[model samples]
Target chain A: MAKVYNFSAGPAVLPHEVLAQAQSEMLDWHGSGMSVMEMSHRGKEFMEIIHDAEHDLRELMHVPAGYKVLFLQGGASMQFSMVPLNLLGDKQSVDIVNTGHWSKLAVKEARRYCHVNVVASSEDRNFAYVPAEDTWQRDPNAAYLHYTSNETIGGLQFPFVPADQGVPLVCDMSSDFLSREVDVSKFGLIYAGAQKNIGPSGLVVLLVREDLLGRARADLPTMLNYQTHAAADSMYNTPATYPIYIAGLVFKWLKQLGGVKGMESRNAEKAGLLYHAIEASEGFYHTHIDAPFRSRMNVVFRLKDDALEESFLMEARKNGLIQLKGHRVVGGMRASIYNAMPIEGVKALANFMQDFARQHG
Target chain B: MAKVYNFSAGPAVLPHEVLAQAQSEMLDWHGSGMSVMEMSHRGKEFMEIIHDAEHDLRELMHVPAGYKVLFLQGGASMQFSMVPLNLLGDKQSVDIVNTGHWSKLAVKEARRYCHVNVVASSEDRNFAYVPAEDTWQRDPNAAYLHYTSNETIGGLQFPFVPADQGVPLVCDMSSDFLSREVDVSKFGLIYAGAQKNIGPSGLVVLLVREDLLGRARADLPTMLNYQTHAAADSMYNTPATYPIYIAGLVFKWLKQLGGVKGMESRNAEKAGLLYHAIEASEGFYHTHIDAPFRSRMNVVFRLKDDALEESFLMEARKNGLIQLKGHRVVGGMRASIYNAMPIEGVKALANFMQDFARQHG
Candidate 1:
């Protein structure tokens, strides 16, 4: 089969080497005579796999000692509910920065449990830029401040983490989790869905501070409680075992590639290549995002001539670049070059974009 | 490496052919040039995959019309909360049958939401047998009746489905699902955690009647609401995509083997062979489970001389059979032979047991 580059937002592309290794170990993992999928979660083999995954992740991200890393299920959407359920101990409200689609979703779910304060929003400018920190309305008595570091569908990202405001800072870093280096001690909690920068869907990697544990209401479901998972080392029930195993392999891959620092350099270079192609096209291609807030993960753009959009996508697909269609809400083209999207794949898309523009310019 | 049979209670063995096909398509699926893991959940490729999975599941189980099949996460433990949260629309109490470890766990979670009436219990016999239906204490105003169909740890199963009591029947069939044919219309909801008899961990397959939708409290988290998933066909959130794909393959394998009827016969024969060996050992091996209530999925037994138990397990591992160790609470041996366990594996275990008894009796 011809090689094809997948630019899916997520359930997205993974490192080819990781997939190859998984295929090789599909029947028996480390001579255990049992596939990772078939082994008991309590068994020594799976225990070692999960432990090593957490250790590698902590090492790569410089996770602080006071935080507990939980490999949970139900994706980031589940976190929308859990954040409020666990964080709203005696507080009556939560401050949320609504940047775009995903941030608004967090606000929506949080509203179900507490008074949600939209501290600041970029909706006035169609969410193409981040709100300035000085212009924000602060909630003095809020339980915590929550924000999404990256808006996947809107192709926007926060230029900087919010300053701590006495309350805890919680971030939904689902799309840009391991793509760059960050000071882990700056935030109280951070979470990412594994499909984008890590491994597979059905697993969410959560890092919550120890102080935030044991605050959930007694009525909260056991599975929804972070304390339950933290106490049991995330083995409160049968976890998504195979997904965790795959995520472990991805962590190892990242470590070999110089951890998050190496990934950041490669990701910046890949994003630079595509953005450069769009900008160099002059009026032929355009992007609505502000330069400072543009995501290094999802690069969204459109052709100057609206009629050429379909032809651009169809021709790109023919050239082996697929899933470049932008989100339905923002119709155009989006090349989501996540961490696993190689530099060569990004270069191919950039070249394809430039050629398509020349033909229709 | 030589072949070995795994008898894990959950996160148990899967069909070899399914694993082989998954391995073969690890890098690229069919001609799509994208592994199923890399495909977008909303993309046409994954849309077809999820749709076919639902179709195959319905056909194999003879699922009644108006039943919404939801491929969800969070496992059966999640359902313990969802059951009462969604079903207790106007009622304040729910009737529950306490059969064993799994059932008691469900009861523990349900107590956080509503008044739980323990209608019947098998705890008197250490959960060795299912309580007689006639002895149940009826809750006339109960919203529904919930029970565990098979206890994986206690090695007990209900001899008959409880008769309808003017309310819905919600069953936790996590261990016994797809091992036999059942009348789907007898229950309003059925859920299985997919690891035991179907695919992998992290994905929970839920079947709920249409009438049960739209009953969850407005304050309930959207992710926990059945109406939210049913209205969107279980794509309300990014589901466990790869697990669903593997489960789809298992459904196909089940169909090729003549569906649940064929699997039921095979399970019975396998259980019979192991149970017969234990009974004919003349007190060398003992099982406390009543004959009528013995589970066909998990066959639990203890050596008459408890000190030799360690030797028994060590010798079994030497013979290429593994994971026969029982649950920690039950200090004995349990061989979980779900639908994927070939009869040959069961025969091997039976022969091993006889030889061990002859050498040590």
Candidate 2:
């Protein structure tokens, strides 16, 4: 089969080795005579898979003792509601830093449960950059401070984690999870959909500080309550078993390549190469995101001539690049170079960009 | 590899052919150069996969035009909460037929949102039988009548759908989903976690009558709201894409085996073979469930000697029949013979039971 570099944001590309291993084990996982999909979630075999996944993730992230890692379902969108339902407790409001698309959605969902205090917003500049942290208003009484670490759609990312407010810090890290190193102790909760730089869709890996567990509203749906999942080890109901298995395989892959630190360096190189190509295009290609806040995972840019954008994508596909079309809302091209994206794929895309621009310019 | 017959209750056995197809397509789906797991949910390729899956499922189940088929996450446990949250519009109560474990859990979740009027319960008999329909104490003012069509743990199934009680009917068909033919017009909603008779864990297939839409409580979490999924065709958020693809393959496999009607015949034959083995064992084996209510999907039985149960499971595994252990709540063995568990597997288990009893009885 012909191979291509897939750049779709979330439900995006996976490590080829992981897929190959999964393919080989599809019918009988480790001679258990059942596919991982067919194994009972409560069974010993699957328990090992999930346990290994969580253990490896903790080691990779240096997660502290008081943290609980939960493999859940319903994606980041589900977490939007869960964050407020679990963390709001008796608090009257939440503090939010609106970087872009994802943060806005988080704010919208949190508003249903509590007053959402907009501590800072970069929307005034069309979300092209992160707001200066010092200029942000602090809500000392807010239950927690929340932000999207990376906006997949707008190609914006926070270059620095906001300093801990007096309240707990929560983040929607769906796009950049595991792409870089972070201090796990800083966040009250961190959740990311598995589709990006992890495994497949339908699984969300959540890390919540233990002290924050029992604060969920009593009337919250049991499945939506963090305490329920935390208490049950994310098995209150059946988990996304196959996705978890895939994620475990990915963790192994990541570990072999030197964990988060290794990934951070590789991702930096890949993003730097692509950005250099774009800037060197000398206006043939342009990116709105400020350099300080530009997302290393999703590189969004537009062609100089609006009419040439379609041709750019078409030619990119011909050169074994696909799904490079940008979000419809963003109206350009977006090349998402998540951790799983090999540097070779990014190099090929960069070369193609220069060649396309040279011809079209 | 030593092939064993897997009898896991949920996340149970799958058709070998389906696993093979998925294995072959793991690297690149339909020459798209991306695994189905890696494809963007909104892309044409994945869209077609979901569309065909819904269409084929509708055709197989004979789902009426008035129903919307939703491929969702969070399992049937989530449905326990969603049902009451979505269906309890202006009504203050709902009727429930509590047969066993799953039924009791459904009632628990429903109680949080509405008064759960238990119309009938066989818990008096250790949940071994379905209660008589005429003795039901259904509330006339109930918003909907709900029931667990098959209790996976207790090995009890409703032989007949309850007669209408002047309200909409909702059923958790998780364990027996697609194992038998049913008139979709009879129920307001039917939901089943895919792990049993469909695909993998984490995906729940929900069939809701279109009229039941738009009745969710305004305060409900958007992900829990059926209207959000229905309006987006189950793509309100990133779906469990890989699981849905597997389910789609399973639908195709079921169709090849002649859809639900054919599955009904095959399942009945498989269950009949195992039940006959138990009955003919002459007190060597016992089953608590009444014959009429015995689940064709989960065949629960016990060895006459309690001490021999462990040995039975160990020996069964040696003979390549695995996961025969019953739920922890119900001691003994439960050989879940879902649609994918071949007749040969049942025959092997039957023969093994007879051999086991001959030596230990």
Candidate 3:
């Protein structure tokens, strides 16, 4: 079978090694006579899988003490509400930096539970760049300041971690989690849907400071309350067991390649290869986003002629490179080269872009 | 490796054929050069998988027109809150029948949003039987009448569908969904976690009457509201893709086995084999649940002497039967013979139980 380079935004490509291991263990995981999907969440075998996954992830991210890592479900969308439900304790509002699509979603969801103060916004410029730190209007008594470290749809990323003031910081790291190294202690909470950097689409990883655990609103549903999940170790109900097992395999894969730092280096090299091609293309291809804030994870760009874009996507698919189409909201192409995307795939994509540009220009 | 029968509840055994099929397709699904896990939810390929799953499920359950089937996350536990949040619109209270563990959980969660009037409860009898229908005190003006069709922990099932009587019937069919045929038109809403009769954990299927779609309270979070999912076709955000794919395979498997009627016959035969063994054992082995109310899915029982139960479990495991230990709340043994557990496995379990009783007695 011809190999293909998959670049679908989230629910994107996974490390081949992890899929191979999972395939081998599909019927009888570790000689347990049952697939991981068949094992009970409370069983010792499955428990070990979840425990090791958390440990490896914590080690990879250098997560500090007194922080709880929760493998949750409902994707990052659920957390937009859960964050406010669990953390808004007596606080009437929270601070938000609205960068693009994801941050807007967080803002809309948070507004259901609390007053979402727009501390800073890049929407005035169609969210092509992050607003400067100095532009943010601080909310001293807000519950927390929330932002997207990387906006996948708009192809913008925060170049610098916002300075941690005395107030806690919350982040949605769905697209770029573990793609680079970050100080875990800088944020009070970090959540990532597992489809991108982790493993699959069913599970989400949540890292929350211990102090944030029991402060959920009393009237919140048991499952919606963070403390119920934190206290029960994220198994208050049956978790996404099979997905957790696959993610554990991914964590092991990351560790074998030397953890998050190793991933960051490889990711940087891949992103550089593709971005260099875009830069070399001159006026044939264009990335309108500010250079510093152009996302390393999602490279969004437009071709010189709108008529040529469809042909470009069609040809790319024919050549076994898939999902290069951009978000529908933005009429351009987006190449999401996540952690599992190898340098060779990015090089092939860059070569294709160069060839396509020469023919179309 | 010794082949073993898996009996642990939720995230229990799936068909071996399903596991094999998933193994073969893990890396390159139907020559797409992408695992189902790696596909975007909006892509045609993954969309087909989700659509086929919902279609097969609808066909099997004989879901009527003007009903929407939603594939969701957070399991049935999340539905506890969602049910109230959605159905409690313009209503102050709802009637519930508390049969056991799962029903009580629903009651506790619903109370947070509405006055949950528990019209009937078997709690006084330790949930060993369904309270007689004639004795129920259901509220006439209740927004909806809710009940657990099958309680996994107590091994209790409602022998008869509760009378609708102009009130919308909402059922949590998590443990027994698709195990038997049901007239879907009778209930306004039904939800099942994809771990028992369905496939894997982390995914839930909700079938709601079309008219019931948009009544969710305005304050509900976007993800928590069922209407949000219905509007987006369950892709308001990235869904549990892998689990949904697996569940689709399960739907195909069910179709091959001749749908729910086929499952019912096989399940009845298997359950009969095991339940007959318990009844035939006289005083040695005992099932405290009323005969009519005993669950076809989870068969809960105990040995006369508590000391002998450990040895029975140990020898059973040595003989290749696993996960037979009962829940902590009711300490003995529970053999959850879901749709996937073949009759041979039930025969093996029954034979082990009879032989152990003969030897120990």
* Candidate 3: tens digits of C-alpha lDDT, residues A1-361: 5999998998999999999999999999999999999999999999999999999989999999999999899999999999999999989999999999899999998998889999999899999889999889988899999999999999998889887687799999999999899999999999999999998998989999999878888878788887888899999999999889888999899999988899889988888887788889998888888989988899999988989988999999988889999999987999999989988899899999999988887
TM-score of each: 0.99, 0.99, 0.99
User: Per-prediction DockQ, in order?
Assistant: 0.86, 0.85, 0.86
Worst 10 residues of 2 chain B by lDDT: B161-170
What lDDT score is found at residue A13 in candidate 2?
A: 93
lDDT of candidates 1 onward, in order: 0.93, 0.93, 0.91
> How much is the lDDT of residue A115 in candidate 3?
94
Name the regions of candidate 1 deviating beyond 4 angstroms.
none
Of the candidates numbered 2 and 3, which has the greater lDDT value?
2
Off by over 4 Å in 2: none
Rate residue B84 of model 3 by lDDT: 88
CAPRI band of model 2? Answer: high
Looking at model 2, residue A65 earns an lDDT score of 98
Tens digits of per-residue lDDT for model 1, B199-227: 99999999999998888977888999999
lDDT of 3 by residue, B172-200 (tens): 99999999989999999999999998888
Residue A285, candidate 3: how far off, in angstroms? 0.6
